[model samples]
Target: MPDSQTLGNRTRGMGEIVDIAGKTTEIAPFGNTLAELGRERPEIVGLTADMGRYSDILPFRDAHPDRFFNVGMAEQNLVLIAAGLSKVGKIAYCTTYSVFVTRRAYDFIAIACAHSMANVKIFAGMPGLLNGYGATHQATEDLNMMRGIADLTIIDPCDATELKQVVRAVADIPGTVYVRNLRGKVPVELPADYKFELGKAKVLREGNGEIGMISTGYMSARGLDAARIVQSEGHDVGLLHVGTIKPFDKKGVIEFARRHKRLIIAENHKTTGGLASLVIEALYEAGVYMPVVKIGLADSFFECGSQEYLEKKYEVDLPRFVRAIREGV
Candidate 1:
C-alpha cells in the first residue's frame, strides 16, 4: 500500500484504485472536454473557486481566457456568479471542491440556481472519499444534499469516458446540473463509444438472475470488476451503472432488480440517503424487495488518510464488493 504523499503525487487528490493497474488513464479530461466544447459554444464559460490546478479547469482557462473566471476561495461566490452568468444567457460551468460547494454553498445552489432553473453546471471535484483531507474536504453526502433540491439534475459519472460526455451533455440540459467531478489520472473504464444520457442507467454486465449490483460514480468501475470476479467463481452477477442519481432510472432499476435474486448497492458515499437508499426506495415503492448488501461509508465522519486506507477502513473497497456478491451479504 502506498502512503498518502505517494498516492497524492500520483492521483492528485483523486481516488486511488488497486484494480486499475495497467488501464489507460486520461489527464485533465474535464478541462480538455470543456475547452473543446467552448470552441463551438461561445456561451459556455468556465469558473473556479481558486481551484484551477486541482479542479482541472485550467485547460479551459487557457483555451478561453476571456471567458474563464476565478472567484478566489469563496465557494458561495462561485455558485452565485455562475448562476448570475447563466441568467444573462451564458452557460456557466463552475468547478470547486465538492465539500465546499455542497456544505458552504448549498443555499446559493438551491435558490440561485435550481430554484430558478439556471443553466449553471457545477462540476464538483474531490467528491466522496477521493480527498485525503477527510471529512472537511470529502463531499460524501453531496448527492443526498443536492438531490433534495427540486429540478436539480445530479450525476455521478463513472470514469473519464463518461465524465467527458457529461460535460457536453449538461450544456444542453436546462436547469442546474450537479456532477461529482473526477480529476487527475482518471481511468478509462467505460467503452470509448459509450453515450451518457440524463436519468438513465446503463447495464454494464448481464448475469443469470442470481445477483445484481447497482453503483454510481467511480464505484461503478469497482462494481464491474467485482462482478466479473464473482462470475469467475460460478456465481452469476449483473452490474448496473447508474451515473445519474436524481431523476434516477427507476424503471431500469426495477426491471434489473426483478431479474436478480439479490442486490448489492455500492457507492463512494455514506450508505444513508445516497445510492443505496435510493435503490431501496425505488425497489420498495415498486414492490421489488430483496436482500441487499450496501457497500459504502458508514454514518460517521471519516478520518484523513490515503484513498486506499480510507476505502479499506470503511469497507467499500473492491474486496468488500466481491465478498458481498459471493456471500450474498
Candidate 2:
C-alpha cells in the first residue's frame, strides 16, 4: 500500500513536466483549461459547489455530463463528494468560490482530502480580491490558509497561458491541489509561444541597471509594464514572471537577484503569505540581500468593484507599480 503522505505520487515536480506551449490559447473561460484536460483524459471528473457556472466549470459539466457533479451550495459536501470520487481512482476537478472553499470548507479539504491524499484539484474562483461582491465573499487570505497545510499543491497562475498549463499539470500531480483562479479574461502576458512548467520561473525581461520585479498572477504583466516604463525613464528593471506559487523556484530567483541589488515582489495577494513573503524568506535563507518592495493588495478586504478598480485601489495596477518604482529610485 502506498503511504498516505505520498498517495498522489504519479507526478512530482512541475519542473519535471515537459514544457507545454499553451501560448497559442486565447483569453476565455477557465472552461477551456478544464475542457482541454477533459478531452485528454477519461479518468478526470469535475465537481462544483453551486458555482459550476461562475467558477467556469460549466464546460466540463457540459462535456462530461456523466462525470461531473454539482453539489449545490455545500462546500463541505463539495469536497466530500470529490474525495469519494477520487478515492475510487477518479481525477477530480472541484470548483467553488475561494471564500467558501477556503474558510467555509477548510476542514473537509484539510482532512477528508489532504489527510487521505486524494487526487482532487480544488479550483477556487474569485481568489483574493478579484471578486468585488462583498466582504463575506472576499477570499483575501486563501493562499495563506492553504500554504500552511501539508500534502497540498498550491498554484496561482499569472495569465491564460499559464492557467491552461497549470490546470493540466496539477491535475496530473497526485494529492489535493488548491488553485486560486480569478474570473474573467486575463490579459495575454507571455508571448504566443511561451512555455509553462510548474515551479520553473521565467525572466520575461531582466534589469539592465539595478532593479528587478518578480511578480505573480496577472500582476506579473504589470511588472513587465513597470519594467518597460522604468527602462524608458533611464532605469533598467528586470521582470520575472512566476506562474506557479507555493512550491516556488527559489534557485532561479536567488540567481537572478544576485545580479541585481534592488527587487520588487508584485502580486494580487495580500502582504501575508503572498509572493512578497516567499521572496523575502527565500532570499534570507540564501543570504541574498536586495531592497525588496511589494506592489500588491493592501492589508484590508476589498470592497465592491471590478478587477481594474480593485487593482488600482490596492496599488497593483501598472501605473501604480511604475510610480512606485520611480519613488524607490
Candidate 3:
C-alpha cells in the first residue's frame, strides 16, 4: 500500500483515484487519443466547461484550437453549444466534471442532445468516487441520472486501453453518448489486443459455476484482482467486465449469471441505482435469482479525502473485494 503522503501527493489536483502500483499506464490517454482522432476527422470538435486541464482535453485543444471552445464553467451552456454544433453536422465532443454535467446540466443534455439524438459525445471526468473532492465532485449517481435519458448511450471504460478505444468508437456511433472519462496516468489493465464493443460485456475469466463477478469502470480491474485472490483459495471465480452501461448487454449478463451459482456485482457508483441495480433488474426480469453481493458506495454523500482513505472507509478497497468473494457480503 502507498503511504498517506504518496496518496495525498498523487491525488492533489486532477489526479487519478486508483492506486497505480506496478501497473502500466498512459498519461492523458483521453486527450491524446482525441487529438489523434481529430487530425483525421475534420467534423469532430472539442469543447470544455473551463475543465480542459482537469478533464485532459488540452491535447485536443492544442491540436485543433480553431475548433476547441471553452465555455467558462457553465455546464448548461457547454451542452447547448455542443448540441448546436452537432446540429450543424459536427460531432461535438464536450467535457466537464461528471457531477456538474449530470447534476447541473442534465436538462440541457436530456433536451438538447438526447431528445434530438444529437451527435454530441460527452466525456464526463471524475465519475463515481474517482475524485478526492468529496460528494460535490464525485459523480456517484451520474450513471443513474444519465441512463434514464432516452436515446442516450452511457459507457464506463475500465482502463486507458478501453478509454482510448471508446474515444474512437463514439465518433462513429451516431447519437448522444455519455462516457465516464478516466484521465491523468490512467492504468492499462486490459490487454493490448482487447477490443471494446458497444452494448456488449466481455468475460475476463471463466469460473466453474461457483462464483462470478460483474463489474464496470475501474472496479472491473479490481474485480479481476479479487477473482485471482479467490481462485488461489480453491474457489472458481469468473469476471465479466461491462463497459457499456446503458443499452446494457442483458443477454450476456443473463448467460453469465446462469453459469455461476452466486454472483457479485461491483461498480464505482452507488449500489442502489448504478451497475448493481441494473444487473439485479436484468436478472429479475430474466427470472434468474441467486445469492449476490454488491460492492459500491452507500446511498449517502461522501466527504473529501484521499482515494485510499475514502475507498477503505467506504469498504470498496481491494481487501474488501477479497473479503466479499471469500465471505459473501
Candidate 4:
C-alpha cells in the first residue's frame, strides 16, 4: 500500500477536465451508428429537444431528415412526441440532457413511456458527473430516479463500442429504455471485436485475492486504469464493467464477488440507490458477505465547475481509487 504522503500529493496534483482544442475525437458514435441504422430500419426515427448538435444526433438528422423531429426546448413535449411516434409503430429515439429527460420529463417517462410500454429509447446525454453546470446540469441521481420507474430498462454503456451496440439492442425491445449517453467525441475503450449484450456484465480484467473493481459508464475507464496501477504496485485487482444498470447482472455480480475477498464498486453517479445499492442488495439476497467500498459522488448536489474539476473534488477518479485501496477504506 502506498503511504498517505504519496497518495495525498498525487490527489492534489490531478489534472482538470478539459477537451483537446485541436485534436479530433472519433465521430460521435451514437450519431454515426444511428445514421447507419436508420438506413436499414426506416421505422427508427430521431427526436431531440433542440439539442441535435449537442446530443450528437445530428448525423441521424442529416441522414434521415424526413424521419427526424426537433421539438424545441420543451422536454415534456420531447418525450410525449416520442411516445406518440412509438404508438404509431415507430421506434422513437429521443435525445436530451439526462437532467432534462429525468427531471423535466419524469412524469411523461413514467406514464407515457414506461407505463404504456412505449418503444421509446431516451438516449440521455451528460449523465452523472459528465456536465459541470452545477446541480441543474449534472444528473448525478438519474439512475436512482429512473430505476424506480417500473419496467424501464436502463443502460449506461462504457464507451463507443458498447454505446453503438446498446442503441441497436434496445431498438428491438418492446418497452422503454433509458440510455446514459456520451455526446461529442466519445472515447473508444473496448477492443474492435467486443460484442455487447443487453442485461449482461463484461469482465474486462481478471485478478484475484485483492479488490474486485466493478464500474459502469465512463467510470469503467477510470477503474481499468486504477486496476493497472494496483497491479504495478504488486497487488491484484479485477474489473467488471456493468453497463446495464436497471436489470443488473445478478449472476455475474455474484460470481465476481465470490472470487475476490473485497470489492470496490465505482460509478459516476451518487452511491445511494444506484449501482452500489443494487450490488449490495443482490449480495444480501444471495447470502454473500464481503467488505465493499464505493467510489462515487456523495449524497449531495455538485456546484458548477469543469467536469474534470468536479470529479477530482468529489474523489471519483483513478487517483481516488488508488488512495482508497492503499488506505484500506
The most accurate candidate by lDDT is 3
lDDT of each: 0.88, 0.75, 0.90, 0.84
Q: Model 1: residues >4 Å from true position, as ranges?
A: 1-19
Worst 10 residues of 4 by lDDT: 9-18
Query: Model 3, 1-329: lDDT tens per residue?
Result: 32333575345434474446667778989999999999999999999999999999999999999999999999999999999999999999999999999999999999999999999999999887778888888899999999899999999999999999999999999799999999888889998899999999999888888889999999998888777777768987899999999899999999999999999999999998889999999999999989999999999999777787788889899998998888987
* Candidate with more favorable, higher lDDT: 3 or 4: 3
How close to the true structure is residue 271 of candidate 4, measured as C-alpha lDDT?
98
Higher-scoring candidate on TM-score, 1 or 2: 1
Q: TM-score-based ranking, best first?
A: 3, 1, 4, 2
Candidate 3 deviant stretches above 4 angstroms = 1-5, 8-19
Clashing pairs in 4: none
Off by over 4 Å in 4: 1-25
Better of 1 and 4 by lDDT: 1
Candidate 4 structure quality by residue, lDDT tens digits, 274-298:
9999999999999999999999999
lDDT of 2 by residue, 1-329 (tens): 10123213232111111112322225444777788778889999998988876777787778889988888899999999999999999998999888889999888999999989999999888776566665677777787788777887788877677777778888777799888774544546677677877677888886774787888777786576667666768888887887767677899888888888688888767878877888899999998877888777767866665545555667666677877678872
**Reference-based TM-score of each model:** 0.95, 0.88, 0.97, 0.92
The 10-residue segment with the lowest total lDDT in model 1? 1-10
